[model samples]
Target chain A: MSTQMLTYLFVGLSFALYVGIAIWSRASSTKDFYVAGGGVHPLVNGMATAADWMSAASFISMAGIISFIGRDGSVYLLGWTGGYVLLALLLAPYLRKFGRFTVPDFIGERYYSQTARIVAVICLIFVSFTYVAGQMRGVGIVFSRFLEVEVSTGVIIGMAVVFMYSVLGGMKGITYTQVAQYCVLIFAYMVPAIFISIMITDNPIPQLGFGSEVNDGSGLSVLQKLDGVLLDLGFSAYTEGSKSTIDVFAITAALMFGTAGLPHVLVRFFTVPKVSDARLSAGYALAFIAILYTTAPAVASFARLNLVDTVHNTAYADAPEWFGNWESTGLIAWQDKNNDGIMQYGAGAALSPIKPSFDGNTGVHGERLLSNQPTESTNEVYIDRDIMVLANPEIAGLPGWVIALVAAGGVAAALSTAAGLLLVISSAISHDLLKKTLLPKITEKQELLYARMAAAVAVCIAGLFGIYPPAFVAQVVAFAFGLAAASLFPALLLGIFSKRANKEGAIAGMLVGLVFTFTYIAYFKFVAPELNNTEHWLWGISPEGIGTIGMLLNFAIAISVSRVTAKPPQSVEELVDNIRIPSGAKAATEH
Target chain B: MNSDEHTKQASDVSQIDNQKNYWKANLKLLAKLLVVWFTVSFGCGIILADWLDQFSVFGFKLGFWFAQQGAIYVFVALIFVYARQMKLLDRQFGVGDENDADQESQS
Candidate 1:
């Protein structure tokens, strides 16, 4: 069968499977909608959490980014996984014991103020919306590239599928669907990785393959070969990082805390049956996530080596089939800088505008004519980092079925995460904003109706973002992590660890963290893009890492304010004492 | 009546003391595990990465391996250890899940 037909088959089959699960496990009550009736097994919840955590960014973009950036990419590898430690140890079990339906529930009750709940809801919405937009765009990209459909049409289809499961079955549906997605995505990710590993180093396991010598007669290790080639091309050694140690440290810290604080991920813990289960599930989730995370670096190095070997100094007329395929998609481009037909892949930008602008005409060599002016640098190729994973199978000449599987995997990743985020957003709106605060007198059945309505509307908005992506969609991803780290993480941690953390202190801390982190990112990203370098960054921490400072400020302010303010009420103190123990969690969930 | 009140008060004090001791034990365990967590990730992975790169195992620099792979494996282990230890702690303090279910039924 043709690749397109297979892609359709795989994507169609996977979608049908997800929809089947949704129908089989339809939610009936508010509890089911909110936390899957809090009966999910630890292993099942772990799988779901893995799918929910690994978004399109992880599935599609991360390895590619690491391929281009080299060792500095360790920041993402360590930062993302390490945060699960904080979650499992510091947050998940205690929150499970608290037995709340939503994060805001804990903040609201622990601080003993409705105002704190509203604040948390706002933070939750901002973080979740910023994240969901990226997932939608990811879906559109995969559909447009693989399914041969328009980006808008792809986004609409994605939205419809998400709406079907999430609105109908809520968390219950999302959990089971995510398990299926985890299987599809992991298989998709590993198959190509293993194929490429053997092709490059004769080792079947990518993790070991990357550390082994190249299979070719040269006898150089993969990393050694990569470092030598990159250095020869005027790029830094693949094993060395260009970023300062402090910046790397700060960015890693921010992502770790941010991951733990993310409302969508934290809510998954509440679905499990017991406090111990929550801790165990977090471990399982990380183990599942680690399978991909450890393999990604191997893929990164292997893909980088393959790219340079296949394309560098090759005549344009003789370029590999995959080159022209990706070039037609505007993700890869080559220009004859020296009037030589040979391609040069080097360190700097190939064109002045960075992205190619097709001129609707073919050059003498039949390469697409670009309006972009050639830069003075030696580089003559522009490759979008996002295409590495998508183009990997083709680059290595893998089977067409593997290519089709990748397409399905990418969609599964985007949709699964999108569903999880939408569920949390809807629950936050219906559970926290409406039932808990604004319309406290609403019936349980009415609340369920509102949750579905909120999910439907949220899906539409998310789809719109995918169809008409904002210019800042790519830039604001940092804001999601930063804000989560600076605001919600500190507030949640303080609420659980310190009983004296009154509403006034918690509110003040969140505002300070949010405002400070937001302003820092905006100033660097928009107000003065030219000054967004290490020299201008505060304490040598880039805007991406400033969240670390913001988090510290939150901790300081909350602790000081709490000390100065009156102690929390006796009841609030008792609540803290109760959550500290593992018993009575079942009773706590009853309310 | 006086004797009965005194015995009830004594039992309440002992229960409170047990709760306090359980919390103390939990905190101590957390401190130890977190030290390992910090050492592996922030210590070996970041701060000492360059220094530790002088050593290599199977072509992977020691620090690079920790930064990319070792720290993550350790994180998974830490959580499991924490889960098991906390379970034992719950049992010791008579606060395990089964005990809670039993108490609820009696009430």
Candidate 2:
């Protein structure tokens, strides 16, 4: 088939599969809509959770990130996966036993205050929306590449698909569709890794590929060869670590705790049948996720070496058309800086597009090259991390269909996550803010209708914001994690575990946490940039690491406030005990 | 209120004690899990990553590996430990279901 036709074929089939699942799971009642009738098999729930958790950031950008940063990127590797451990051990089971539809529900019930729940709803919305903005952008980027559509047009198309499934079926539809998406994306992720691993190191398994001998026939292992190549290019060795130790520490910790705190992933545990299953399913999710996590570093190593070898120390004046094609999207670019028309790429490029300045020699004069100029590069190597996963098939000269499958996989990842977060956002709006707190008399069916409306409206707003994402995939995602880590996590942890955690204490902690984390991130990411003040940065921590400090403040404030305030109600303490032990709990009935 | 029900209630008190004991067991398991979590992540991975770097394994920095792949593998392993404890809890409490899903769904 023609590439265009084949691309549409794969994307269409995948979309059909998702919508088909959504149709099959139309959710007859509020219970079905919110938590998928709480009957999802542990394994299926695990698969859905994997898809829900991976998001576009994981499937598309993570390895790409690792490949570029070398040893410094280990922070991401540890932080992202380590958080799941926290989720499994600390949060998932108890929440399942709590029999709540949303995280805020638990907060409200535990604190015995509608006000506390509303505060949580606000925090949840801010965090989830910020996170979804990145995924929405991922959808646009992928669609533009595969479907040959404008990025804005792609965003609209993606919004429509998310609206159709997520709005109509809610969590019920999203769960099954996510299961299918998990299969497609993991397959798309692993296939190229396997092929390249075998090609480069004669190891069929990517995990072994990293430690095996490189094809260079130099009797050196892949790591040794990589270190040698990086040194030759004035870059750090592949295996040698260079990130500021403290920063790596803070970032990893923040992300780990953040994962445990994210509402969307935590809520997935509530969909399983029983508390024990919730605990077991969390393990299943991690085990499924670890497969990709384990393989990713090896894939990244292989790709980096292959990329360097392909573009550098070669006679090829031109890479294939895909490089230029993606470059026009402003994701990848090259400049000729030394009045040399040829492109040069490597360490000397000094990271980032040369501010379009490196090539004063190009269309504009006297502009210092901001990005790599292959013309100036002695060994060409201008690469972008976002391209790493997508370009895998092309890098290995795979067929067009495989490349098309990758594009579909990226969309699947973005859409699944967007749907999940949107559901949480919509639920917070209609369930917590509207029916529960604002209007106590709303009918169940009417509330469900409002949820559907919220999903559609949120999609449009999210789509608009997604079309103009303010940060890169990883950075924007960090903001979401930061907000969750600092705010809701503390309230939930304290409310159940500490009998003295009254509504006033919980509310105060959440407000302080939310304000401090958001203000810190906003001040740094947006406000500080506007002020142009490099001297004002405290501790050299970006908006990303600020969450750990914010989380501490939340915990401290909650504990201190509880020390001075009235204890939580006797009934509330009893409820916590009930949540702690399943104790013949009946099926949850959403009202 | 019946004589037989009252006798049953006396036995139920012992069951309540067993539940309390089970809760203690849960707490111990949590403590162990948290310690392992802290050691793998904060100890070898972060707080002492450099200190542990004084030791190396197969040219891999012991601390850095712990911070990265080692910690993650241990994390994956940690989930199973928690699951195993959950099963034991079920056996002691007579609540664990064996039809639960196995954790290996990786493609």
Candidate 3:
């Protein structure tokens, strides 16, 4: 069968499975909609959480990012995984004991202020929308590539499928579907890794394969060979860091705290049966997540080495079909600047396209052969970072079925995360905003209707973003992490850990953190990008690392504010203590 | 009235004692686990990464391995350890399922 036929077969089968599961576990009430009726087993919830947490970024873009950036990419590897530690230890159990449906519900009741709840709802919406937009874009990219549809049409199809499951099943539907997604995605991710590892190093386990000697009989380890290849191409050593030490530390810290604070991931713990199960579920999620995280670097190393070997010094006329195929998608481009058919790619040429500058040779010269044309560089062959993972199987000459599986896996990862995020957005609007505050007298059935409607509306908006995303959307996604870390994490942690932290303090801390992180990112990323370098940075911290500093500011402000503010009411104090001791908890019910 | 006051005083003292001991144990456990978490992730992964890179374990630079894989493994282990420890603590403090509302309250 043709590759297109296989892709349709695999993608169609997965979609059928998801719809079937949604029908099997359709949610019946608000409780079911919010927390899967609080009946999910720990291991099952763990799998679902893994699927929900690992987005297209993890499945599709991570290895590609790592292959290019080298050791500096460890920020993503360490920062993303280490947050599970904080989640398991600091947040999951206590939140589960509180037995709430949404994150804003916790903040609303814990802080005893509707104003605080509204603030949280705003933060949750901003974070979830930014995140869901990226997921929708992933869905579009996979569909357009595999199913031969326009990117917008692909997004619409993806949004429709997600709408069917999420609106019908809510958290109940999303959970079981996510379990299935986790299986498909992990299988797809590992199969190519194993095959490539064997192809290069004669080892099946990618983790060990990454460290094993190359089959070329040079006695050099795979990483050593890869480093040599990269260095020859005028790139830094593949295993060495290019980022400054403090930036690495700050970005890692931001991601760690941000993952712990994301509302979508936090809400998953509420689906389990007990407080103890919440902690166990987090561990299980980490274990499941670790399987992919550990293998990604290996795959990255293999992909990088394979890619360099295949492309470098090869004649454009003799280049493989995958090159032309990707080139047609506009993901890979070539210029042949020096008029040589042989492509030269290196740090010197820089993958970014050169803008035609109009000044003289001393400044930004346009189309002028400057005196400093080092090494007769043609500067051809620019490849998009996003295409590396999707193109990996084809680059290695893997079978057609494996390529199809990758398409299915990318769809599954994006759909699952998008579903999880949309549910959070819907629940915040319907359950927290409408039922809890705006329309308290609304019945549970009405609230459920509102939740489904809200999800539909959110899907429409997310789909639109996917279709016509602002150029800044990708850059602003990281700010979502910073916002979560700076605003929500401090409030949630302080609410549980400190009995003296009053509503006044929590509110003040959240605003201060939010405003500080936002202004820093906005100024650096948008207003004055030229000034984003270390000379202009505060303490040499990039906007990406500014969240950690903001979090500290939150803690300091919260403590000081609470000292001067009135104490929390007696009942709120009791509530904090009750959340700590998880003995008398009950399943979440409609208000 | 006199008997009621005596009983109230006794229960209050014990309640305070339980709260104190429970919090103390919880704090100590969190401190120990956090130390391990921090040491592995930020310490070995970042601060000591250059130093540890000189040593290779199974062809991986030790620091690179920790940053990528080892820290995650330790994180998973730490959480399970914490869960097990917290469960025992809950049992010791008589705050496990013994005080839970009947199973019917659960879904």
Query: What docking tier does model 2 reach?
Result: acceptable
Instruction: For candidate 1, give the lDDT.
Output: 0.93
Model 1 bad stretches (over 4 Å): B1-10, B99-107
lDDT by residue (tens digit), candidate 3, B1-107: 47857886879878667866887898899999999999999999999999999999989899988887788889889999999999899888866744344654443
Instruction: For each candidate in the order shown, give its overall lDDT on alpha carbons.
Output: 0.93, 0.78, 0.88
In candidate 1, the residue pairs with backbone N, CA or C atoms under 3 Å apart (3 or more residues apart, or in different chains) clash, namely none
Per-residue lDDT of A496 in model 3: 92
Name the 10 consecutive residues with the lowest summed lDDT in model 3 chain B. B98-107
Which regions of candidate 3 are displaced past 4 Å? A349-378, A587-591, B1-12, B98-102, B105-107
Candidate 1 lDDT over residue span A30-58, tens digit each:
99999999989999999999999999999
TM-score of chain B of each: 0.84, 0.76, 0.82
Estimate how well candidate 3 is docked, as a DockQ score: 0.58
User: For model 3, how does the per-residue alpha-carbon lDDT over A1-591 read when each residue is reduced to its tens digit?
Assistant: 999899999999999999999999899999999999987999999999999999999999999999889888899999899999999999999999899899999999999999999999998998898898888889988988788899999998888889899999999999999999999999999999999999999999998998999999899999899888888878899889988899899999999999999999999999988888898899999999999999998999999998888887776777777886776465665555655666667665533334222123321211222222233444555667788889899999999999999999999999999999999999999999999999999988999999999999998999999999888887887678888999899999999999999989999999899899999999999999999999999998899989999999988999999999999999999889878886656633333
lDDT of 1 at A345: 93
The candidate scoring highest on DockQ is: 1
lDDT of 1 at A246: 96
Candidate 2 TM-score, true structure as reference? 0.91
Candidate 3 collision pairs = none
Q: Runs in model 2 with CA error above 4 Å?
A: A313-316, A339-342, A348-382, A470-474, A530-540, A587-591, B1-16, B51-61, B94-107
Q: In model 2, how large is the Cα lDDT of residue B96?
A: 45
List DockQ for all candidates. Answer: 0.66, 0.31, 0.58
lDDT for each residue of candidate 2 in B53-78, tens digit (9 for 90 to 100): 77766435577567547877888889
Write model 2 residue lDDT over A1-591, tens digit each, in one string: 876788899889998888888788897766777898888998999999999988888888988888888776777788888888878877887788778789999998898888888888888888898889888988988988888898899999888888878888998999999999999888888888888888888889887677677776888877778888888877888877775666676677778778889999988988888777888788889888888887887778887887777655433245666655665555555544444544555675533443233333323322123444244444333456888888877777777887888888899889988999999999888888888888879888988898898988999988988777765444667678878888988887786567788888888988998899788777766676664233454465556777888889889999999889888778987777666664433333333
